[model samples]
Target chain A: MPALKKKITKPPTAARMVEDIIGCKWSLTVLSLVRSGVKRPGAMQRRVEGLTAKVLNERLRKLLRYEIIEREVFAEVPPRVEYRLTEFGNRFGAVIDQITALDEERS
Target chain B: MPALKKKITKPPTAARMVEDIIGCKWSLTVLSLVRSGVKRPGAMQRRVEGLTAKVLNERLRKLLRYEIIEREVFAEVPPRVEYRLTEFGNRFGAVIDQITALDEERS
Candidate 1:
């Protein structure tokens, strides 16, 4: 019984979680945009050719949940919301930078 | 027409290619094992908790296609085959190492 349980149960590893976050093509594009200083939702949609509002929101929510990125809402006449990487997220981005570096190094 | 075509066609970037490779959870596990020096396919199947021979072979073939890992066959009576990372693959591993580092740094 113990052996079966051990075989069946694998913890949600940080690495696995990271992999899940980056696996989606849209997620990778979103993260890349955010990393490259495209912060607001509108700008992100514009920068990347076909990123729609619905999908962008979904990815943003997922990124927020992972603590890889954060959202900030302003108190102006029209509330301007922006997203940016958290401290841990910035560190996470550095790892992703390695992926970007992989292409550069090889090229 | 050119603008429409440009919007519709996004070139396959190297980073995206790398993402597609690591996107497989099993691939990540297999690469982790290979990086840790577990070389043989049979040994790899035994080492991971629930990895089936079929799935492992599928992953191995995919990794080989991406040129991430290579296989070698010995000339002994009982042929011995072992897999190792290529030069490009070792560099790819370094990006993966950054991900492993992310967990360690936070913990």
Candidate 2:
């Protein structure tokens, strides 16, 4: 007889994804910077004080994993990488903007 | 002379509050249960598997701290406590409903 199994891990939902994305203060800050057209990693690192390259890379990877942001590589002698929100991310950003406004109102 | 102090904590914004509230799997589950009419603590605890009284109390306290939910006590032999969403929470709930629909679509 086959052994019975129970799945303990549930797939992350949209809400869960949002929670995960914004749970970190740095991730939230990074998302805002990316939304405001600060695209390159180096630029983002410079823009946010105390944000190290390693941590920024991890945050960027997470954003990419969740389809919140996408990267573009330009063909050049020195390659240029830039980040932008996907369509879904744009929609998510709209919700975030609402939250920002709500924050302004409440705080 | 008084020692110079550096403020280490950021006052939680509305977005931060939402992030904190939904960051925990159990907290998100409890919030949903409360939103769906699971008012009493005992009932909420029974409704969610693996939710203990201690954890439920903690989540409830966090919710009350954020002003997301308010509690009412009734006079009886056994005092009855009920939880309900505040006006701000209702607005927050509208955003939550949007996220629920989004989650249903994405997941």
Candidate 3:
């Protein structure tokens, strides 16, 4: 006789994904800026507007850790730094952009 | 001469909206459940899986406060309670569903 089997199930919804996406305060903002072509960290801060220096730095670090953004350092005087969205991050950005567009259209 | 007016600018992105949507840990979960047609508060708790009674109650209150969900108390024995998504909440739920669909497609 075959052994009785138990089926493992997964949550039908994307609660985990939603949780991961909105876990950070500045994630969406950072993604938006990166999508808008602000690759430099300094410029990202400027584009986000109203984000404090400390918060911006922390968010950038978090984004880097999450692999949502990549950091590249130039081998030059003063070390030019650039941050760009990874493929995954770009996909997330597209979702955010669509949501933002829908939200704006409602206004 | 017209005064050189300062542009009272608004944040170009939806930081506040994102913040508002994810402000509560259970907002997304609750919205998901409501969209799936689990209306009663008790049933909502059951559908979310892993949410505690306390958390579910608190989340329900928060969802009510945010106007994302509506509460209707039926005039009956023992007081029947039901919850439903407002129109705005339905729109938000559609976005969430789309995101969830995308996430699932990636798997």
User: Best DockQ goes to which candidate?
Assistant: 2
Candidate 2 local lDDT, B24-60, one digit each (tens): 8777887888888889999997788899999999988
Query: Least accurate stretch of 10 residues (summed lDDT) in model 3 chain B?
Result: B11-20
Indicate the docking level reached by candidate 1. Answer: incorrect
Clashing residue pairs in candidate 2 are none
Question: Candidate 1: how large is its RMSD?
Answer: 9.1
Q: In model 2, how many backbone clashes occur? A: 0
Q: Cα miss at A96, model 2 (Å)?
A: 3.2
Candidate 1: regions farther than 4 A off? A1-23, A97-107, B1-68, B74-83
Candidate 1 lDDT tens digits, B34-106: 8888899989998999999999989888777667789999998889989988887888788766666766666
DockQ of each: 0.23, 0.30, 0.12
Q: Compared with the true structure, what per-residue lDDT tens digits does model 3 show for residues B1-107?
A: 99898988543233344444554567677776877788887787666678888888887786666556799999999999999888766766666656666556656
Error of 2 at A90 (Å): 1.7
Q: Fnat of the models, one by one?
A: 0.39, 0.42, 0.18
How far in Å is the alpha carbon of B14 misplaced in model 3? 9.6
Candidate maximizing lDDT = 2
Q: For candidate 3 chain A, which ten residues in a row score worst on lDDT? A: A11-20
List per-prediction Cα lDDT, in the order shown. 0.77, 0.80, 0.67
- Model 1 lDDT tens row, A42-89: 999988888899999999998887778899999988889999988888
For A1-107, candidate 2 gives per-residue lDDT tens digits of 89889778664666666666656888888888888889999999889899999899999998887778999999987999999988777778777766667666666
